[model samples]
Target: MPDIIRLLPDNVSNQIAAGEVVQRPSSVVKELLENAIDANAKQIQLMVKEAGRNLIQVVDNGMGMSATDARMSFERHATSKIANTEDIFHIKTKGFRGEALASIAAVSQVELRTKKEEEEVGTQIIIEGGQLISQEVIHIPTGSSFQIKNLFYNVPARRKFLKSNSVEFRHVLDEFHRVALAHEDIQFQLYNNGEELLRLRSGNLLQRISDIFGRKIKNLLIPISEELEWVKLSGFVGKPESAKKTRGEQFLFVNHRFFKSTYFNKAVQDAFEGLIPQRYLPSFFLYIEIDIERIDVNIHPSKTEIKFEDESSIYALLRTAIKKSLGVYHVAPSLDFEQNQDWVFSIPKKDSPIEEPKIKINPAYNPFKENSKPFTKAEKLNVTEFYSSFRNDDITSDLFDAPSANNEENFLRLMNGRWMIEHKGQLWCIDPYRIHQTILYNKYIKSIKNHALSQQLLFPLERPVYDLEKEKLISIQSKLFAQGFDMQIEDDLLTITAIPSDILQEKVLDIIEELLYQLTEHSEEEFSVFFSKSVSKVSAKKRNEFIQSSQIRPIWEEFKNLEMPYLNPLNKKNYEIISIPNFE
Candidate 1:
């Protein structure tokens, strides 16, 4: 008999933890930036090379660690943030789970240089794969400088899984944005491959937002704040028109810690229900402040998703805050900014109308000709010969059967926006324009779409998304596939050659984008009925209007039955015309 279980090696244990903590380069960025913020640094500088694949360095002017503390900082579970198990529930600082440094060091080559403000000398600690390689007392800056290089170098399998440098770099940028947004009082600077990307100076929250996104967005944002009994909510929400088609601009922070909460997100969305177009989501950067004891951030490996004692209250507060802000801003009501701030002057004179050009029309081409009236049943039957002349039996059969399948086909559009085929007996209808609006709204609300790749583009086009949006993109791969996007990762770039559904591929990209933006906010199910109804109406209208045999002679001549009378008994009520109902 032999023992069945055994302890895993230090390297293996560290690697397993690293898998959870450092899923990508962005994970590393989150850890390092959090550590800097926890250190109470007023200024933090982030620099990345090759989208963080080559190098990721964070230099912060926070309170530096002592010589002894610097060496111990690399040890797993060794943290100054938490004293015991009770401290886990009341975590206030960002880097409480000492595992970040240890996990980070396990998967990459890490070098730490830190010194106290009063001390003349600083300590440098270097580690790789959970093993300390070097520890030296060196003269450097007053805060902390962490450099992580050759990530997953020892684990080729993990390294191979790494997306392109650009993708990885986007992740880093995301982490950088989260911390920067949370702590507006701290100055943050970021450089990528020797190019200055961000220079965020310490100031008000609005200024910090402008620094990160750009000055153009500042004017597009509305201030949102609400102080509830236990929770304090404050942030700026983008005006409905300002939200982008993608999921790049949403930010949520809990007690200065960046985290994701679907409950909270729903609250914000509920608030903007009627104001924002269904196809577009509101852009917001909101921070929630609550008691440390009422929340828990220690559950997840990376500490991104959180659990609250009273999430419903928090959610409601968020929704109300955003809604109130929208009301105050009068976003829907067009504001006369010109009149609001007065200093008007000149009055302009009105001009007369311009002359119209005369257009001569041929009597044959005139739609309003004396004998041109709506087609009657006899006329429709006569025109059947003309319609039949254009195509072969297969095309004719399909066109004839199309009316029967209209309900099912339209229902499919309502259910999933694009298409889905089901039995016609199960569907209903609504206003088509409203269906379009609803579908667009639903898609926009769930900005991340999973579309399948149809075909690659002939030429590879390169574009950029904020580094923070990488995770969101990765999360939305399946939806993108459903939407018909064939995408691949090459560094920070997302190469798209194909779309998910064949229908979207046929349409122009701009139209597709419009559909996406519009349908994202509404309920696909609700819009389905409307969509079906509209499609059915239009299709029915087209079916009733029959043309003469002479007009369609070239196409319909082959299938024409000139001798047969084309009488439709149920043209308006039903598509098919039955000769006689058999009553038994």
Candidate 2:
């Protein structure tokens, strides 16, 4: 047998390398933006078309490259930032390996135009599929411009794996935010398909954050600053009021480079332990400055993961620093102000009659009574009968057969939105909230998938949305429409002419805002589920209130109607039965 192993050709090797360096259009965006920053550009404009499937251009006004350097940029392993192995440990620039350009050029059509400030003319280099097409003198400005076109054109499989335009554009926006956020002194502007999405002016970190997010973020942030022997940290963490159900707003950077560390994130989350809800995450943008030698950034091809020398110490310090900052300011904002207190001692009209409410006392009921039983067995049959109704459905609930419901008006309702039922000497606890949420979720999904039912409002409702959430809302407009949300965007106002029949118009804005937050962290599919869940949650609360005042007859009927009543949209148990011990 002949020796099968052979060295891969340059073009093949570069294409293979591109697989890791340029996984998606957003990956290309990250590389180009970092390169512009490494060039010491004061003003960088990122221009994209068709969500980066067609074009991705980065124009910068910085120190330009020479003609020789322009030609050498597309060569594999060719770099200007690194000299030897020792230099790798003490690196400062973003693009040092030089594989970015070479791998990027191998998979797409690239055009580079650059000229030094002192040079009278510029050089233009074009490469297609790793082949240099042209290198000629051209008249241009005193900076660099890189235009990447037809990303992954040669590789059909990669292109086939690309997500929707909305998703791709969203990812691009994420990269843009990460880069623009870490460097506050550099100006960055983003243009998506001819429309200017973001215009970030150079300023302090706080102002930069407000520019990227909305002006309202200023009120929600708590400033954090600390300096130690090995590490110095400074950033703003979101107040508890600013915490959201989604966890996408957190950002951590080192040496003006954005990276991700789960350990560090836990440090921040731990700091906000009692301030925010358990599932909710407070937004934070933390910057840490340390000696470059103490960390490693080359672990991943994207260069977003860093391996630190004393990670445990850094984690403890970060937690303590954030906790200290949180203590300095109040977590919950006080919205109440001084007002009239006349209502506290109101005097009714002289002729008006006031009736004292009557309270019924159970004469025989006593906590000390040994004969006090859990809920009666009749309520057991009510629940057993409810589950038995599902026996006709294909998915059997594996519950025991029970008799028909005898009056459910006497069932006991616990204070915490739970219903007590007795079955076979076992006390069965039922959660009406989870049941209603799940039923509404299934109904909404069915409506959205089949044909949605919408109610046209008498007048269009206008809701104020910030610039940060506008893109997300717009991206899923079609999906929202399918779910019966007919919306139009003009500036920051989102006008809704119709809403789903299941949703209350009064809570539409809140639900939409929650949906926007969900979209920030979840994909379109996941966001749709979250959207349904949120709407169901709102509807479920109202439903629970209605059931609270009325008898349990309606609840029994609703439970009996569901094909699968056990699945909860909130990932909680609908009901649980605990056995009661018999004591003589």
Candidate 3:
């Protein structure tokens, strides 16, 4: 009763540690890749099956360990990187806590094969459920290969919590990207279910980034490099136009280790304050190098969070560096006071004299006469009729005129591109664009729901998009087809053969592009919300085109027919009213 709390068993403690270190397949991928890097691997290959739930294998050409050292590597807190407590702060390698392998082995079936460069033979070891199965001497290559299978097999609860393969694969890809980005010189390859996903060769930072994201990113990157007393920053920031609505491409690395820091992220984002649209995050790959003593990497088990000695200074420096790079690359505006040679004008010779001015005038023009002659009979009749038409007309006459029984003409007046209507001594100013958007939004929603008519195009349109975008489009192809879009995908180009009748032929491409952008922005939103937003955006774009009064009458009629004409689809006020006092 006195000693209720006692030491937990090694297996139990190891499994508990696995909860933090090996959260998912991605966590396993990260730990294994870091271990490979720490081993001074020049080339590494990662093979995964079923998003690492079934199998995860890593083969690296690095310095392998001896048999005794290999056996001891899986012991809890057994590490060669750190000697004592003093080594925690001054850390250089990726793995120092030494809990990664122990924890991973506790929940997965592990197999290890290693051979030192100086050894003539290698050792093959297999373990399951945190217990070593067998160790045998075998002849193998001078490196290490680790195979982890049945991840979380011993922990059924953890296995059950894993997400779908697509989601889990995305996380795995994220981890692979972080590790591959931090070490550009190491050759890395990734394969899923026997299909190659990424094959990165040894290159510089920029080349590595371009290889991973796509070669098109090369032109969009702005180089940033700054060396200071406290910190050194280097890498690239994307141009403002290349900014994305999602926060997927942003990365920050410290001392060759990938980490996340909201403080540092905000600093970089501040540099693009006015350059990018609101809520859009810019793609950046920034690397920060500082003294090990100035940072505590052990603050988090994942080692993604670090406490800096002078965060404020680092933030200021990072922001300034990124801003300077943007200015240098002409991605951001800069003032240049230096004169341009092409803009200079040559001075006239001293011998040349200025020319005298000459003037011409019509001296016979009359001050007050109609063409210097009396008015004709027809002109007199026109003038008399024009004056008679205004006899009973006043500023308030038309304002008070009600619509006729025919309803062909509208009483709404167009002033400065806005519609104004007067009723009961009060004037209402309406935004025609907003009202039209609401009307079209409702119309399109109904059309989509009812499978409205689609106008087949005489000439199909083809648009080129990236691989990721093509995948996204394919995922929602059925929904698009249901919405009156007859589209076909051929490689990276999307060909449109038909579109909704209401959407103009010329605006089809623009509407599709807007839809894709919205898809990227609201990927996590429900399908209903996504569909509504896509239709609304397309309708908004069409409403911006110039419309004649005749065309506006029909749109205004539709708007009036809406149940909520005072508000747009987004619930924003579409018009405002003001009382104008009549003074006699």
Best prediction by TM-score: 2
Which is superior by lDDT, 1 or 2?
2
Tens digits of per-residue lDDT for model 3 on 1-584? 58788899998999999999999999999998999999999999999999899999999999998999899999999998999999997999999998999999999999999999999999999999899999999999988999999999989999998876766776788899999999999999999899987789998998898778766778788889999887899999989987765456789999999999998999999999899977778989999999999999998889999999999999999998888877766677643322434467768799999778789989987777566677899999999998877756442345424566754443454545666655345677767777777877777777767776888999999875544455457767887787778999864468899987877887677666666666642266656456665666555634335344455666666776785468886677778886787798
Question: What TM-score number comes out for model 1?
Answer: 0.63
How displaced is residue 532 in candidate 3, in Å?
A: 3.1
lDDT of 1 by residue, 332-438 (tens): 43334224334466564568555688999776676655775778999898899888777675353331224343341322222322222222343222222222333
* Candidate 3 error regions (>4 Å): 1-3, 335-449, 452-529, 537-584
- The order by descending TM-score is 2, 3, 1
lDDT (C-alpha) at residue 401 in model 1: 25
lDDT of each: 0.67, 0.82, 0.82
Evaluated at residue 480, the lDDT of candidate 3 is 78
Candidate 3 lDDT score relative to the true structure: 0.82
Local lDDT at 36 for model 2: 86
Give the Å error, residue 283, model 1.
0.3
lDDT per residue, candidate 2, 334-402, as tens digits? Answer: 222223343376688999999898999999878876885687899999999898787554563223223
Q: Could you tell me the TM-score of candidate 2?
A: 0.77
Count of clashes in candidate 1: 68
Backbone clashes per model, in order?
Answer: 68, 0, 0
How well does each candidate superpose onto the true structure, as a TM-score? 0.63, 0.77, 0.73
Model 2: runs farther than 4 Å from truth? 332-431, 442-468, 478-501, 505-510, 517-533, 542-553, 564-584
